[model samples]
Target: MNLFNANETKAQFILSLLPITLFFPIGIGYTGIVLFFVALLAGGQYRDKWQAIKDSPMFFPVMGLLTVTCCAGLLLERPDGFWKAFMHYQIYLVLLVFISVGAGYWQQRALRVFFAGAVLASTLLYLNAFQLLPDWSLFQNYRMYAGNKSILIGILLGIAGGWMLNQICANHGHKWLRISMWLYVAVALLFLAKTRTGSLIFVFGCALVLLRYLTFSWRSVLLVIGTVIILGVAWQTATGFRERLVGTVSDIKAFVDGGKVSADGIRLEMYRITTDIIKEHPVVGSGVGTWAIKYPERAQGLMSAEMATPHNDYLLYAAEIGAIGVCALLWIWLTQLFVAIKIGGENGMRLFTIGIAIMFGGLVNAILRDALFGIAFMILLAIPLAGISRHNYKSHFGDLDR
Candidate 1:
């Protein structure tokens, strides 16, 4: 029994490291994922693990998504593309893995590890921004070192900020420290990273947390007004924030007025063309991997540049797997939100906060299509979600078996 316990402890330690690995390069993150799964296998509780997965609220919606992907792939006769897409979608299964392996106090420990990782990564980014790090070409920018886009960095920081806000709402100790951390994240995202998507997501997430925690009172109203004022002041004063906002408006205007394709304009054009494609094949889409094959043909000479994805997850999924796939995708997100609401605590708020970030991030970027962001999304989500599941299981079954 002692030997078994030691092995289990080792396995759980491996699971704990997975979230932090996401801040590193994609290869390192992938290695962590492999080690996590290996640890799960080594733990050796197949029956209980399968039961845990089945009991989770995410099971059916996730399964529906997989089924839709398969049907779309088979119907379109692109067996190769279907297989590739199927493998990509397998990342969702990590949620079930988390639900199965994470129990008792392990969930909270993993969360701390995740937050610590985010804080460390953010510090590195700041160092890179100020050129305080060792002078190396690879360390020149946060993106180069972290192997992620500026938008992704912004989203991560925004989510971290939301998590900090949740901590404050819970009335946990270290109030001032949490507030400072949240402010740090906001400054990094808005001023340093300058990601429009991140800014919007951060504001939305903070608002959601405040609304969830605050009572219906004049104080709440004043707090909301103060937030709006701060944002307004930032808009007027921050050069990066102002330029990005102005640039997006200008790009849209250029596209509408003269059909000129700039950065945002190209995405708009892609959305338009993708929508037409979806309309043509409303049932099962062009196929799982047909976007690259079909989009260029449809959009030839229509835009200045070509992209494999439409930069919108909804449109991308709709065009690839049709309306059913799109519905399944929505089901996955909506159900996750529902579960988070049902949970209703720190864990629930964490899930809700990140869920909003992912949902809003998807509007302008194919976040899940990107390797690093997709893995980060699933793992971050699974940690809190699995915590909620563990709590529910304990309440119902009275302390899960160690």
Candidate 2:
């Protein structure tokens, strides 16, 4: 029997628009989230929702992380900090809601919506990069109307690139088109956006896709070699790319030689301070939201600007919630990857690509700490996982209303 009534159906429809909204301004995405929650409450079916949440493999790990953060916050007498952390981590509840109510059809629809949004956003960015767009200040300098940072845009594009790569691998319709789209995404990330983390994500995602789909062969070897040659040529010729690469190396060398904190130097300093903090509170961490409190105190006159996180997700978690929180974080990522692999379809490939992006991207940025990346990560993860779960359910029990 259909569990959804008219109100519930409307709620689902609103939920389906989330991916597209994410490509808009952040406030619009937040508004959409708020509206969806309100609609969900108006169409409540508590019993079924609870069952769905309980059945999700992600439930325990997510809850565990939440519990740890909450406890750390409360016990450490940092209610304000706890509240702040909760604000960031509350995106997980969105994922839970997705598993509870999102149907396979809606999930697929959402993925398609996301892909379309990505394409449109990419096209605009490309136009803006080339100064082809009307000289609106808002659209200038590769700035996205979505108001996301270039790095975040690159990561999102990397996710889209991964999806296209999967489609090409599966021999889906319009093979050349998919290949062209994939290349387009690569160019956007590596050239136009010029985000190092994004470029790394694209490269890493390509490796993962090829590893998953291709058997070891001479053709694969040649393909890899050719890719390397292209990258080498780009490195030599692309001014922005070469400068960023050279700048990163220079930043590290400057930091090591004279402790001069530059672009990457700030990250190194934060990592250094965070590691000390972790050593002191290795077990339970300094507690939720302690990084903002602790890092400045430790760095003192060393860092020029205030930083909330260490800019590295693993280190941030380890410093805030300790090793246990780190474990929970890893569990969340690994479990999601496992599910994506088990599903092993186009949707699975999409999820897998996102997983790679967040996991690798986390090394350079505190991915979950950022509003855009965090929200995108959870929603994208939930959509694909929900679809996979629905498929598994139908396989075992036959199709229901969903």
Candidate 3:
């Protein structure tokens, strides 16, 4: 059932090289395009392989989300926005299809290169943190075409954290090397970069890995709680942490007391406005690409934040496509979670870790808005899903190599 033929060799070769641009946002996008073309060229050979997707739990949910998005876009009467969403979401769906078809081969072949790329990215981010790299500042919170550095680094750190946690739980691998690497990544994230969303992901991923595999007694649980408390205390004592905490509170209070807006306050207001928009167009939302057009109408002269989408992904989608879109979106995420469950054990833990992080990121930021994070997340996610599926297939057929 080898789908890759001599005709597909060049395509696979180009696909393998896609990981080299893991750190570069634009580079990942370009590589994704190449992967898409390669996937299309080789897809005909893998008709049977592609059929395996029908057996997957995620197949329906993913397709449902895509169908809903497309329909909403078209129904909204925004052909331009519909086209834009089609291109963006269609790429993700295509990636899922490509990965599912090549599941067995990709992890073994491409994962190492991707991890190495992540390591290099980690090193570069560290250097940038220390200002060792001129003009390469590490505080990239905003979305950019190339990618958000903070978001990218945060994801890399989460992967690194998960890898290290897997090693610890398995009680194997280069223990000291991983520890050192883990510390390095943690330092870069918690102290150097100080990306709240990324740090949250790293912590969440590590916690899940440990919880999934580790045998925790009462004493161990207490120890974990103590460690978290200490970390919380330490964060409170840090100057940057204090400022962010105070700023968040001050913004909320200001908005409540005087309609004053701070950075965070603006996001709060946006959520409120977006909710109103969604309420008005609950079924078959206002339309795709009309956030900009609709947002001003809802703002009611409250603030000057000119943006198309809300800070939250769910609200953004709901506002655009209504309840159906929301259901489809949640279905997609739920399928990811269910698939991760089907892929259980250490590998499953890793995938679930990333899945939760992506979900969490969508809550606070526009997950799909950042092309780099979205593309990279899909690639990383694909490897695990493919690996798990192949492993299951082999196990089920009693064809596992002995």
Candidate 4:
């Protein structure tokens, strides 16, 4: 193959592989390597994508946040942490360029690639649950043990459920296959995964699908409400589900009452400590990658082990780069939600539902802290945004239209 053709083909192949990589930590690393090659092979396309990134509504806020964080990391004189923070900035830059340059090609293939990845993840997760599969050491670190696994699997299932609903509504896929995929995702999330957060998000996403596509018939509305009530009652009866529900209450009680050290109590104490530290450097903040350093001093006496930043991303950002950083991050998030809804067209509500779940889930859990989640979120977003921009450009600015 000619060098240019080889470059284009290889770049497309790597973009297709992205969705499957979301399932494994090793895959995440491999995906990055592949993306680097894709960028290098992209050549002249890089200039076009740079312009695309410039025109993207989300570009400024996201890049701005990254720049501010890097500056904070430098100001702290954290030679150790500066590189880590810089690396994150690099990840975003690479992803933005890759997505913008490849958007037109990937948009058509993204849905198929996404579903293919879901099937692979579901199969492996099922095998792992049944102990029928041998452990691959590379993916060993990605194991979804109780809480963490639930969150990750739950997020994937939620997205899958939305995809299933989209297919069913459009009547695009096989009827039986769509029904079965939704059933599997629901079963794995509720029965096998048994995560409260995941289950809630999945249900919320499904409800949006129903409300968005289904006509607002009074009978259907009542039936949906009745079904939800019955499900709520059933959820309460499940032993594991019940324990989580009750445990949340117990944790709150422990946090408030003068109870001994508990999981919830420790988290609350850590928040209190982090808050005090934020007050110390309220304006510019303690700087990125310095969480481990600042957290130890305040949380040392209160907890047995040093705590990480608060379990929350917003709080983490506020503590790291101060409220200004928080504002910038929020701007990017809100714009993403807005853009997802706008570009998503008929399925806009569905996009909003999933996007909000990811954002809210991050607030309560450490979802955004994981590099994999950040990468996955960008992939999910870039496909749609790229298509939207491309269509608009062709319609309004391209020679034929002009």
Per-model TM-score, in order, reads: 0.88, 0.86, 0.81, 0.82
**How well is each residue in 90-145 modelled by candidate 3, as lDDT tens digits?**
54575565454544444534555565665666676666656665453232332221
lDDT of 3 at 217: 76
Candidate 3 RMSD computed on C-alpha atoms after optimal superposition onto the true structure: 4.9
Per-residue error for 277 in candidate 1, Å, reads: 1.1
Best by lDDT: 1
From the highest lDDT down, the ranking of the candidates is 1, 2, 3, 4
On the 0 to 100 scale, the lDDT of residue 3 in model 2 is 32
**Full-model lDDT, candidate 3:** 0.63
Error in Å for residue 272 of model 3: 1.2
lDDT for position 120 in model 3: 65
In terms of TM-score, the best-performing candidate is 1
What would the C-alpha RMSD of candidate 1 be, to one decimal place?
Answer: 4.2
Model 1 agreement with the true structure over 249-279: per-residue lDDT tens digits: 8888876786575654678788777888888
lDDT by residue (1-402, candidate 2, tens digit) is 223335336667667778876655567778988998888788778797777787777788789878877777667636356677756755576688866774545565566677777777678778877767776553443554232365666677777767666666666676667667766666666666657776677677777777777758775666567557756766776678678778888888887787575654577777777899899889888777777877777777775238767788899888878898888789888877787777676666667788878888788887888777888777777666663342253211112121
Residues 206-283, model 4: lDDT tens digits: 777667666677745754664476457647655675677677778777767867646644666666677887887787
Model 4 residue pairs with clashes: none
- Please report, in order, the local distance difference test score of every candidate based on alpha carbons: 0.71, 0.70, 0.63, 0.61
Global Cα RMSD, each model: 4.2, 4.5, 4.9, 5.2
